[model samples]
Target: MRKIIFICMVAATLFACKSASSTASTSTEATTLSTKLDRPTQVAIKGNWVLTNVTYPGSDYIKVNSFDLADSKCFIGSSWNFISNNNKGTMTLNSASCTAFTSPIVWSINNQGLFVLKIVNPGTKSKNVKEGYLLKVAGLTDTSFQLIDNINVGGQVKDVTYQFQRAN
Candidate 1:
């Protein structure tokens, strides 16, 4: 009788532990799915965008220029700009003629519906220009974004705002 009772007690304890473990595992799986379903989709800027406005410190200007984005490449007029990862390669401005310039920029988006572009100047061993640029997307639509360029000029900060409407 004593041996039978001891065996029953051990079996009951094992069953209880298994039940608790299964419940915990099930809840954890549900939580994982819930979190994944709640996550927002990432945004990618691709297609044609038009320039609408430019706001500067003392003046505001409207841009008649438009651009297109494909893959990681951006085409402005005749100029082509390529962005890979966080590195910006040399771009050629070819509205009519080709002019080459290099700008180091890091692009990111925030939860506050803002597309931020940070420009960093990586100096070469012989030449270096340490300048920074900040561009904020003020208003954004499915195919458009209003770009506000805040520049530091002559120790004073200025703003150049432009509207970009996606074309493609």
Candidate 2:
């Protein structure tokens, strides 16, 4: 009986220490998903960056509402600041042709290499923002990175890529 109890305890401890990526969900809502920070990625992406480009299969023809905040074109010159220490940041839209916008954001890069972001309104708190976005982080380097989001186009799925470069 003593041996059996010890084995059970060891098993329980290991099970409880399981990584989140082993059971990560597909939910887009930040609050419902595991936003575990990838320390290496966190350190690499900490700084100000600009959305250099936004592209997809038919990007020229269709307009996508990126992050449900602004048109995809509006993000071309947008600025993003990621503070990895606390996983907080801000995204500012700089398109003079589109609606001017900026907002505080809470963000994290999960173990699954997903960038989870919640955009908080100017006067509203981030915790109250129920909706959020999850984008796959790809080709991340000290100077550049890309966030890839999938959207349904004409009943088919396509990837929308947002390229970012370190701001001078």
Candidate 3:
């Protein structure tokens, strides 16, 4: 019937419009995220970065007391320094739970252009058995920087964003 044909046409047209709108919105979001980073380069990421905040939802990491972010006191004096010439870095933890935790790390941008932080030597003898993660540069400026990393939890991957401020 003509009525059925008309209804089908309307439905298809509506679906098309929605798809176009969603595509446009996604493009806008990508642009926004790119702009926020200032497109941080190797030189831009060099220097001292003091941990400012850590956030993860429904994570047992918070309950462990070791990685708690509720008060941010655990990372109050933590610092990460990225060296300019060699792509090497260091992490210093000053909190009581993680005091004297300093380790050498290496960093580089992966093929996908995401930052990758790696521990130079995760020796079995060390008490601090922390590893590194690949980070997405969220935002970068002269005095501030932000990064996000994804971790798998119970088969579901979750994103954890860490914010930092320039120390020097």
lDDT agreement with native, every candidate: 0.37, 0.82, 0.59
Give Cα distance to truth, residue 1, candidate 2, Å: 21
Inter-residue clash pairs, candidate 2? none
TM-score of 2: 0.80
After superposition on all CA atoms, how large is the RMSD of candidate 2?
4.7
> What tens-digit string does per-residue lDDT give for candidate 1 at 45-81?
4333444334455442322221121211122332212
The regions of model 1 sitting more than 4 angstroms off are 1-44, 48-53, 57-92, 97-106, 118-132, 152-157
Error of 3 at 10 (Å): 62
Error of 3 at 50 (Å): 0.5
Candidate structures ordered by TM-score, highest first: 2, 3, 1
* Full candidate order by lDDT, most accurate first: 2, 3, 1
Give me the overall lDDT of model 1.
0.37
In terms of lDDT, which candidate is strongest? 2
Give the TM-score comparing model 3 with the true structure, all chains together: 0.58
Sequence-dependent TM-score of model 1: 0.39
Say which prediction, candidate 1 or candidate 2, comes out ahead on TM-score.
Answer: 2
Per-residue C-alpha lDDT of model 2 across residues 1-168, encoded as one tens digit per residue = 999999999999988774444222223322344545688888899999999999999877898888777789889999999998988898999898998888899888887788877788878887677667778999988889999988887878789999999998
Instruction: Provide the lowest-lDDT 10-residue window in model 2.
Output: 22-31
